[model samples]
Target chain A: MADRPPVRDWATDFDHTDPTWVADPYPIWDELRQACPVAHSDRYGGAWLPTRHADVAAIAYDTDDFTSRSVVVTEYRPPNLAPRGIAPPITSDPPFHQGARRMLLPLMSPQVIAKWEPSTREYCQSLVHELAGREVVDAATEYAQHIPVRVIARMLGFPEDDADRFRGFVHHVLEDVTLPLELRLPGMQELFEYLRDQVKDHIDNPRDDLTTALLNADMGGEVADLSHVGGTIALLLLAGIDTTWSAIGASIWHLASHPEDRDRLVKEPDLLPTAVEEFLRAYAPVTMARLVKHDMDWHGCPMKEDDWILLSFPAANRDPEFFVDPDEVIIDRTDNRHAAFGLGIHRCAGSHLARMELRVALEVFLDAFPVFHLDDPAAVKWSAGQVRGPRTLPVHIG
Target chain B: MVKIAIDSERCEGHGRCYSLAPKLVEPDDLGNGRVIGDGTVPADQEDNARQAEGNCPERAVLLEET
Candidate 1:
């Protein structure tokens, strides 16, 4: 008998995709949370809006109740790309999801990640050293972008020379929306083809690398085939490159804007690890989605099946309920159980590897250049959608 | 006197600690190591532990006084 509240239309032209919103969606997210943490959206074809931390976390881990298969926006899938609608396994519920995750877990283990630290650290240091005497340099393009792609390329046993090309392909695949479907499809096709060829080579050679590992991995009863290898590669490339790139740029931006925090880090380098956790909590790069499997009551709101829910981890990390003084970046703040890497079954598989890269990179940067500052904070540009990061960070090093 | 402890639940078996301080840590069949032997803190070994901790990809190992 009660009139329904006005639905939040997220897919409209007037939606929160404006330049300012793209740069920072937290204020808009905060507003949405206050208005209706579980409001429906007409634009997303009547998907539920879960803006609060607790609501998002609950949905993310409740695999039985909220499944991943139905969460992906089938309508949003660009034409010419492979069908992402074949849910139930890649985006499936329980048992199936658990099996896939368990199979891929070994590839992301701490031992596998540790082997790449030296190279990751070296790559970061080399980038810094290259810009040592320069008065101004694009931190995002030069350092953040370079480190992760290279590390990923090496892990997959791709040649170092292919790093730049692969980076370009990934950037276009994920970022270039202006291009026609004709162009986009080819880009996706090229990437998939390249991966397929590499996977084939690795399968034939059986090298002791990630590509080979994925090729050879037994998904228990099901053997990982080319499509499986392709999917895994695509996941790693997108995750390894985009997430770390965003975090590094965001971390540097935060440090540059807050000189006092930088000074504290310089004074006490021991806080780098904790600082990394805090940074991740503050600036999580990934925004995940989940789908309600059955009609259920959440936070007193009735929700139907097949409703898409977006979990904004950044918003959750800054939730006052879980973090004390969540807005302020407390470098040494321990007890950080932030879900920057989403919790439970679908948690970021590369979290340890990401931590090692971030820690080593920050450590080497602080050690090598103690008194550097941003050349022009205003010039820092940010990428939009799914992943967020400074497009360019020009810094002046001493 | 001092000792080292590794929480297996937390450990991803990175083996970086053993690589850093072989004398103090040894790896099991799964490459996960336990701190079984005494770690002689020769004045400079503090730096080694610090590096080991810093280099540890997983925050699995804890060094404490016995």
Candidate 2:
């Protein structure tokens, strides 16, 4: 057995699971960036938290040293997990990652996703219409979460009948960060089983969905088993469902707290695209992990093999080294290279789709309830871990 | 006479070039952009095309005027 590195004291010890960090990570992030750019955390069996944009971008680009093979920032590894790994592209590196990505690329491509834009517009508008009679709506639960799951499900060619179930599976795996990975493994296993059945069905029946496209793809070669396909679909669901909603929820949260911005958006609707970009940057959603492949000196910190390092895209967005006013949310901020969806080879495959969803969602939302505000500011609840956003936001929808 | 070009390798698919100057930059199937047509930037749309070049995150787009 390979010996684990001895634990050492560090300047900044971030406990991601802690509620304090979950609620408002910016203060701690600032402390770490100023004091310890490469701070270590003892929570997930000693993980490193990098608060600098350059360091995070370098690590992402240096796939050779910091691999995506084991992205979860924990020492926990299940014996039953496949040697090929949990999810393709996201979990894969180089040759394998490239091939797998090519196969999945068209699903979210401009032409393909453009075909779904009308329906996407319809979905967002319809959801807003449904909330017309409500006095107070939990905008996060009511609005932000509605459109993405259905759109992703339809795009993947999954039966619309089970879209709710699909959302349930996503919440179980991604949002259920209240418990450790050990406890969450059971739910993960269940999701894998469900995805496995879905992939098997696609293989046997041969539908005209994204699954069929992936099933018959010539990706330099082929996956040995259908389980790999199942893994890939599972990965999509994991990546797809929660991420955009977090941004959407955070957008509502931001607008609710800052009515001036909301009023401006309502008055000058043309600014929606720029507002979306700023929202993506200011409340950048996803934080990804990369495993240290070899024991080496990273910047000033002595990183060891198998140690986890969180490349906080949110933190990177606020990196004072790059942006002029890192903390302030400038809606029309140009020259913005924020890593909201991340960077490097494994940048979000569904980014175009995500951008479209956010734009349409906000556009319809502003049009539908231009005068809405948070009913109880104190009651807004946020979800922490991997994907972060407002889980519960009660708004007075006029 | 001039044509625009982009080194696709550097494209992180920011889509700014296309969004800013759609006449010059066209998005490929997955929304990663490329210079449209023989990559020609017409005289009327030259300023829009230049803005796109300035805004691309990866500096992928290139414009040459002769």
Candidate 3:
């Protein structure tokens, strides 16, 4: 009989599913970057992890071959889900994706995002006012979670009363990939239905918000994929809340632990925007993925079709080649160009909005509960690796 | 007289140009950048305009002296 080739083991060596690795991924990523820049694992049907900044940038830039059909390293997708793509431009490839993004991009343009600042500040102030007298605040739920949801809620034309439920849906699809498929399936179903109804509602009613704007968007000679619009809203709900929430929560956590940085910000309020960029650099919140369409050797690692590759923006932000003293949070850090919000065509459409929220979030929290410290930094529980941040941030505010 | 023009294809609307040289760079509704007033970059603000051009990640912003 002819000799058979040994089966390749994908899950060997790298284990992102491990809690220890998830808790502190920097070390794991560093180890991988040094030993194997293009690390592979069998976790999600043979996934690839690119730890270096330059390699990550190259893959993101080359959407021609390495497409974005699956934007998550671990696929929590339900059976019979459309093979085309899920979240509009994020999961879509070019031409189609380009038209879709151009159609939706104007809605989040800098001026439009800037216009929301007053209202975002208003929302932050109200939350601060409510937490004024409290010496203890669950900064995660109380402060961080509220800011973006309110802004997103306003954008979606959803009622404030529905915030908790929608957030639950967001958490379900985006965060709870670890949950059993049966448990996660219902939430996914509900989320799909909700977005579809919203799109339908806008098509009929046409209100004055993102939904209406997306509906009225000219597709620039391309046929409008209503499902793509629905997927865009779905993407908005899933993406909108947690990413900014994590950044805000993690920023406060950093400041609380490092009093000097906290006080520096309080004294030099003008440096808030600069500091916000640094905050994003130090504690970037998202790590998105791309699906391998064709067999290609990337950074010498053979990536097969159907394999998933994670572009760890967080790890990229900390690459020594990219940033000076990448670990330390240097407020007012200049010449800083970190890709907290992914790079290339799929670069975060909500970058401006996320930045505005972070600036206001920290400013409001500092004003409301000054001189706060983590009651037990050890007790801080992070979200399951996908959308990274504190699930419960307990702080003592004075 | 100097002028500013954006390689609309290259510009991803990072908005750094707007933040740096707001007087010259105007952000469209999608946040993609555009040069205001016939893409003219006045001589005095030329440095500021250059700064914007330099800062663009995509190098979409351009300076032209005509």
Off by over 4 Å in 2: A1-10, A78-84, A177-182, A221-225, B1-4, B38-47, B50-55, B62-66
Query: What value does the lDDT take at residue B2 in candidate 3?
Result: 76
TM-score of chain A of 1: 0.87
Locate the minimum summed-lDDT window of 10 residues in model 2 chain A.
A1-10
Which stretch of 10 consecutive residues in model 3 chain A shows the poorest summed lDDT?
A1-10
Instruction: Choose 2 or 3, whichever is better by DockQ.
Output: 2
Q: Tens digit of lDDT per residue, candidate 2, span A1-398?
A: 12233323334456565667778888878877888788887656557888888888888889778778766554464232423467877888876677777777766676677778899999999899899988999998889987788888887788778877887887776656545567788878788777878777887898877787777765667643576677788887768778988889999888887889999999999888878888998899899988787899887788888778888989998989978798998877766666787887777888888888898888899899888888998899888677888989999986
Ranking by DockQ: 2, 3, 1
lDDT, ranked from best to worst? 3, 2, 1
Error of 1 at A181 (Å): 6.6
- Per-residue accuracy of model 1 over A61-85 as CA lDDT, tens digit each: 5767776663333224322222232
Q: Interface root mean square deviation of every model, in Å?
A: 7.1, 2.3, 2.1
**Which is better, 1 or 3, measured by lDDT?**
3
Stronger candidate by TM-score (1 vs 2): 2
Candidate 1, residue A353: CA error in Å? 0.7
Clashes of each: 3, 3, 8
Return the number of clashes found in candidate 3: 8
Which residue pairs clash in candidate 3? A10-A41, A10-A42, A11-A42, A106-B30, A109-B30, A109-B31, B2-B41, B3-B41
